[model samples]
Target chain A: MITATPRKDLLLMGIFTLAVLTMPIWLAPIGASYPDLLQRFAIFGIFAIGFNILFGLTGYLSFGHAAFLGVGSYTAVWSFKLLSMSVVPAVIFGVITSGLFAVVIGYISLRRSGIYFSILTLAFAQMSYNLAYSVLTPITNGETGLQLSLNDPRALDSLVGVTPTSGIPPTNFFGIEMSGYSGFYFCAILMIIGFYISMRIFRSPFGMMLRAVKSNSNRMSYTGLNMRPYTLTAFVISGMYAGLAGSLMAVTDPLAGAERMQWTASGEVVLMTILGGVGTLIGPVIGAGVIKYFENIFSAINENVLHGIFDFLPEILQDGAVAVLSLFVGEGWHLTLGMLFMLIVVFLPGGMVEGFTRIYSRIRNKNNKNNGEAGSVGSAEVQPGE
Target chain B: MGILEVRDVNKSFGGLKALNKVELDVEEGSVHAIIGPNGAGKSTFLNCLVGLLIPDSGSVNFNGNSLLGIKPHEINQAGVSRVFQTPEIFSDLSLLDNVVIPTLASRDGAFKLNGWKRADQDSEIIVRAEHMLEDVGLIDKRNMHAGSLSRGDKRRLELAMCLVQNPKLLLLDEPTAGMSRADTNNTIDLLKRIGERGITKVIIEHDMHVVFSLADKVSVMAQGTVIAEGSPEGIKGDPRVQEAYLGGAHL
Candidate 1:
């Protein structure tokens, strides 16, 4: 009975965006030393948001999305090499190239759906990675990966007399530095834009058709709607998002590597999406932050950190605690992630969003019950007979 | 010219003939009913007409356009819409959303890229969908999920979805197969109302009461061949139809 009205959701999203923009200031005490990590968080959050547009809403789980991300990164790096060192052109090239890649992959993969469609995308991604690493070595730089080279002629830079001694010039936007704090802010702006676009798409008629296709494709087809094009559009849009994230990553770091296009990286986005909540708007962003946080912070905790935390315990217990905890941290991080994934899938199939909403509703219902009881008692005292 | 013309359509599944030299001509604004016993290829014929199944030979023409080797969506683009016997609908979407999809798709044509457009802004489509829903008496349940509707109501919702497309030919495969007496009567009345709207209808039904009540022309098929094609009264008294039904009492 609760129909989703976009106005309330949009207002909530606006507040969330405002909070995110001010988060660095709020977390300055704890996160002052980790600006790079925060930047990565925003970039990957953009990636996951784009992934969610296709996988979550349309129910098309694409395994080849990393190819788009890799393509974007490569395109951005090439833009820096050929054009100005500005991140704008690089990111635009990245997004456009990624969209092109998606159109091809989407056209083919969308012919079949479910597991077969997933496998098709996985195959395409693997092929792309292999090509980047070997076959397209001249353009992609192969195993060594594409990097900025000082020796390479940048016609625009030379003509403008803005040539740098370093092979690869640092990324900037209109003479404003794009690295460090500026880089993070740039990525954050892109993330906000990506998030807003996704929010709009989620409320659109096209979004409704995608959901209809997900719920009952046969029915939509019978209703005279061809589902293939809608699905392909979702795929391309998501690919552009992944491309944007990849482009930002390249612009922030000034390098593009074949590793970015790996199948495991593609799998990571899926994990982030599922862990957050498949269809919820903010769920992917939350999931991305959690997984990235674990990757950066949790993996950094070694045996020494474990021992330091348990220093108050007895000597015997302290040493034993560090040993046991080491089984989960550092080299055992994958095991921990695997276990967490399984637990989430088994216990909370709807993911973190559903869990939070459940708790919120329970608390609200309890408060309502208390208020009802209080009102009944007050009314009883007001009765003339009493 | 007939609104829907199926000329010499033939279909076979691995040497087993499902339909052989089947031909049909449905006039515009007429209720054409196809009735047959089990294994008479009634569903197969309907599927062929709607492009769900391709005939080995012959063409299905809708409004003068040949429907040979066309995709199902393309067939729909040609102004041929269908309602499945199972009442196929997007169960997760509301009844109003269910009607809105076909209305949008019909106007935009197949494979359009109108991203992020508001559905409410299309006043023409909204008015048509509202009118169709009103006719089907599903205006009250417009906000309810299509899946939550009763069996009879789901059928009504499916009908509304089909009607909103302004289809030149509405192919209904058993509009009232699993309904109770009251539901069946309601469906019959609904079909009568639809007939009054002046849209051509081609239905494959097993319900004799439904067929007798609404069909302007009834065709009887047995062994994938039309044994009788005439008025409902002619079909009722036809010896071949009686023989086909004699072996299959349910019909």
Candidate 2:
């Protein structure tokens, strides 16, 4: 089995659901309880989970996933501008459009594997980014971004006899506005659904085929299994997940920028996946939260904050400590992230999941020793693959 | 008529001719061995039959149907399985999964979007895979990663992977290349047991002991062409076989 047993999986799901729903309460101590950043954690978590399906299962490193995310954002915004302010239609349109986009890109890119496949995806994404910025100006609204306007005819809203308001109407689900706590909950529920789907895929026969593709694709063909369709299916599924995440971003704040399709955004998702644990179920979510936390909180640590923290030190030592530490915070927070990435890659190639597994197994081993069950310890130790 | 027919099959890589007008026929339910020196094109011929490498000009017919221009998976779906010399098992997977994959493939054809079914809970496929693993004497370690197994064990796992599909033709390239004496004997016994199931086997080997022990017929190749073909005992007495093994007047 690629994942745990049904009972264990259900238990894991329960724990995850509880933790996510109470994120606002628990994350308050870390100053991450605010709605905007909370929404981001859920949104990017969905993005990274989707990316993991293709990259982790099939070992096809895609560098253009952000293009799907951008497509979704644009689609959702267009839905808002053209159809209505309801979030349902925007999510549906966003997902379907991005899935079609994934079909085209995945079909072409999957012809090559390894570095060539990565380069092909990168090229496609870059082309999409440039097109959205320039050539597709009328459709994408160019560099300034796609946003809803009052002058445009919202046909669906008008048919429902929704009176035109002075200011722009907030995106909503029925009467509940998609902003503040409601917006975060909407994204969080979708993220949980996305996670559940990924878990099912991980345990499925198709998942086994995908893992077989990763292990030895050459042998798979001889075993009478074609890997192309499986990879393509995964690509479309993941692209739809990215689209969902993008649509959530629009629902939370109804704007779609061309910058979302940039190569850096694509690279950020890769970092999140690798940093958490490439193939583990919950690793990418953890990775996304960590990276996003760094992006928001860590970068907000300025020289003044550093000085205040070092105020108890002697005058010279205080200045010295702040000077040295400031390089890794504020505008230099990327330095901290880079070092963490390098350390994780070098020491724990399986990412943070491996680190957690080691710690967990070590604790179990120590407990067994304390209980005088040394004879069974070796056999009882859990394997990483299992 | 033979089950598999190959006529005037040829392949070239630059100036080197890997196979030159190779003609062979494999009867149903018989073991055919191709023995040769390092560069005798034995592997190349096997590759052609499985569509890994297309023959430059020839016809490869299996069960009255041509096996040309088809993908490897499609050829495999047509009932041809291959065991590579290097033992191409899915090392990252458990031994059980290594066998179950082929079983699923054999049942589901080349492609099936079977995402909803729980892979580990499939009792029928699991039973078949376990039976194959048991037949190969690896059932005890079925949950272990295939990569963690020894060289001989990996070969056994690969064989189980191929046999689980119940292929009509099994192409093995040096099945006992790096096995110990006992392991080699075990493999020979395993092959003989599998032969009773009526699966046609084409083996490429360098060991004369294995060739004589299992092959119903033997073909000796030298310089990219078959030099002689006959019963194992008759091929042993052939002079061309001697010349191919030992350089003649030039020595």
Candidate 3:
């Protein structure tokens, strides 16, 4: 019982699929054709989408989502180490493991709300981070991360009699190597499935209930809907999404680090969700891409690239221009991101999606005026014709 | 026995007792209004019954089920709905959504997981919610964000949200606290119509006109105690009830 008609949903999904499939071609002109950045975009997009379900809908500001991501990474990396090098087992293992982890964390943290719940989650995440960095070093392999060793017998791979081309076993789907375009495609497909499921949840009864919880937990309870199960369900689902994203990261680059469990990593996804649009379906994904884009491209913009862009100008003027702009890009990309975040928060509290919709409605209104129609742009709140 | 029974309920905040040895028996299918001056603890007593607060020692039974120490949603599932003093509706959601959420909750039980199912396609709840909105006279503004609604409209929307549940007991705290004479009369009319459904109601109101007009049974609370209990006419005529109202009742 999705809110949108099946036809509309299918059409939207088709457009999304086409865009993702042709990313290599479409993104090439922008110099983002590389598989690594693209895979990262898909992976973090999935992460932020899941985070949005819990934060955007339920209003539970979990300060420890990265614990689940770290758990998923460790689980997948462990699967690669112990089981076969096939990503199938790794993904399955990761998602399930993180979901269980979320159940425990959610159950405890949900006992309280507001900043108290946040502190509880932060405590749990900090505990995990500390354990992973120290006592659980054997399991997480400490700061160096759990990496695949060349000497260890991959029992499932050996027993299944699959031979690798190199000494360092490459993760694969049967014989197809999970590297380069193939790996990006695999992650991209998962990202689409993740997006579809997120859209379904957003349109579902559960999603409404979650939003109700956000609006008024006490009211929802008085309405005879226990918000605990709804919040917990949302939390677990989002945790698994984070887990899937982590597993995808492992699928592309086979390593798990303790730093992935840090509160800062959890904060990063929150930033991405808020920066795009908190509750909107596509906002978090777009936000993730924007953040990732800044992290990669903006940081890669060295003095040389700045100089090249200003090469037409005099040499002294080029140097001065590069110095002035350098604060926003290159090693200071985070400063640009922080400024952008502030601007969005102040001017567009609804985030980037709201900005786009606002612009879109303005265009539509102008077109309507051109066509000489009655101006029914009544409410300040944006509601599309639908 | 009454549908909702409260016995020997006592609640204290630090040293101050909000509800002290309070007792109430609300007849089934009747409007029971509890009137009190400021701080008469009418809200506190209601909170105890609705699981918002746990009393030091008391028994609150609704339909033979003990409601004490239970969750608010559990109490709601046990056939009790409450309208807040200031109309606690989902301001972010549309008016239709605000009503449908409760309708779904009432039909689906306290904690059923329906995350994957589409909400708008559920014609049964949607239709019921629509009709409920019409009942409250907010059908035209159904798609509007509830936050944008006027104060009176917000109260009506909240009423629609509660009425859609069709509960055995509807607890209202000052349903007409701050409204025009017309709005107050409209709310009184709405409650009277709801009364025809034979749904038991426990209303805590300060407005004597509303209390006397709607209440089948009236109880006057003062200083955290039920000082007088009788028919509306009898309670109105009581001299001590007049004193309680005029001389700093400290409800």
Candidate 4:
């Protein structure tokens, strides 16, 4: 059997890139808000990709990755306040801070594996959220969260001679306009790059070793391989991806909050990974888009919207149906998400990609059986067993 | 001088003395077989040699380098490769990939940045892995997943993985533990071929047939200490070995 080639992977990636670039345009006829929805999809897709590298390939399920994302956002905001208002420096600082945070947390948390590892990471993330909200009020601005203020001085603003009416500077990509359509495109490009990098890592030898470690750590150790360094490397790389996603988020909105570091947010990415397909390249993206779509679009559907759809039904059935269905949609959308996650885990343990591959293989197996039967009948005169 | 020299190695777990003042000398290019009953510290002894467990007191020297306090991976880097009782091949990886792992690790010293390079493009490493696979008669199943292989094939694959590292000394824990008669014979042949390659091998086995067929010198242990050391015929006639195996009536 021929193995998958890089060229084939590149072709698939090219198709995905084209699809992502044209999605807003394709969905524009439906609503003017499709672009904003697509932008959120791309950002979360980046976040999920990073999370997958840590949990999916390495088999180390981190439940505190959102902490790193929060750190990235805070770092970006700090950079904006202290240094230039340019998104470049802010993003770079954000990524670096996330890596630093990962190094510290990984050193301690990697001491344990399996569920304990997950708990340790979750605890650490909660601790980070607590600190950001309480202890680090000077930096994080406490529960109110950090937002761009008019009183804050931008030292670079005077050098560039761009005097703003309010001290709060608008988001810009190294002097280039990063607002409206361009900002969304910028985030889309970053997500595509992040996806490409993750794909490269998944196909790399280091990725193979990570998979091997996940399959059997004892075996890899006996082969004279120290698993710690490889694991730490995967963790840091994944953290960097999270940092990138967080930096993009800060750039998009120019605000940072402690809520982003919550353990629930970390668990959300895990949910996304499992819902889409954990090990598959594009599964996490699909998972992220689906969840984000539900969060943004589906959650907006209230009892009125439900009634609008069920208007053609009998009046008695419509009123009762809308009331009951309303409980499962909109603000109750998380209930739907939780149910979908459970179903995916129960029926499709390998996630959505495996489900798709299973169908593909079933068809292939059927065709092969048919060919075998035809060949057997054709050779019946020569040899009965053949 | 011996290639591997262990001096006054002692190990204990809780109140149990697993190994007490044990000394071993493995000459270069010689097959050394270690035989013992259950819980006789044979596995513990092997673990100590490979740095899995540090001896309370003693020094293990390989090629004049002290192995004390070295990690297992470092010990492997020092040209000593080990195979566990169970086939320790990376089950999820292809058989060829399993061999390639150690080949790359051995060349680059455990962790390296050569991950991004294509396996086929690493012609030297690929050639070495292929040759080792061919030697173990697993070239045909190189693309098969290690987990799907039969017990015998898995053992052969593990052997191939170790051989690819070009280790100075091979430490095997029950190399033929769960093999059929045909597989046992194939393993013996492979061991003979490996012996001819001039790498010293230390094997822990329960099978007397394997010990008699392949071992140049046998050291039998009882209760964490060497009870008898001699040739196969010498060991067979020894009263101590007979008593260890059969409750002293045969002795």
lDDT score, candidate 4: 0.83
Candidate 4 residue-wise lDDT at B238 = 93
Show where candidate 3 strays beyond 4 Å.
A1-5, A378-386, B247-251
Model 1, A219-302: lDDT tens per residue? 777666788889999999999999999999998888899999999999999999999989878889989988887787778889
Best by TM-score: 2
Candidate 3 lDDT tens digits, A282-361: 88988999999899999999888998999999988988999999888989999999999999999988899889877877
Candidate 4 vs. true structure, TM-score: 0.93
- How well does candidate 3 score on lDDT at residue B8? 91
Q: Relative to the true structure, how large is the alpha-carbon lDDT of every model?
A: 0.84, 0.91, 0.89, 0.83
- Give the Å shift of residue A40 in candidate 2: 0.2
Q: What is the interface RMSD of each candidate, in Å?
A: 11.3, 1.7, 2.5, 8.7
Clashing pairs in 2: none
Give Cα distance to truth, residue A72, candidate 3, Å.
Answer: 1.4
Model 4, A142-209: lDDT tens digits are 99988887766677766777667754668788677566677788888988888888877776777777
Error of 1 at A83 (Å): 1.8
Candidate 3 per-residue lDDT over residues B44-152, each given as its tens digit: 8988888888999989889898998788988888889999999899988889999999998889887777767778889999999999999989999888889889888
DockQ (Cα-based) per candidate? Answer: 0.35, 0.69, 0.61, 0.42
TM-score of each: 0.92, 0.98, 0.96, 0.93
Candidate 2 on B10-99: residue-level lDDT in tens? 999999999998888899999999998889999999999888998899899999999999999999999999999999999988888899
Write the candidate numbers in order of decreasing TM-score. Answer: 2, 3, 4, 1
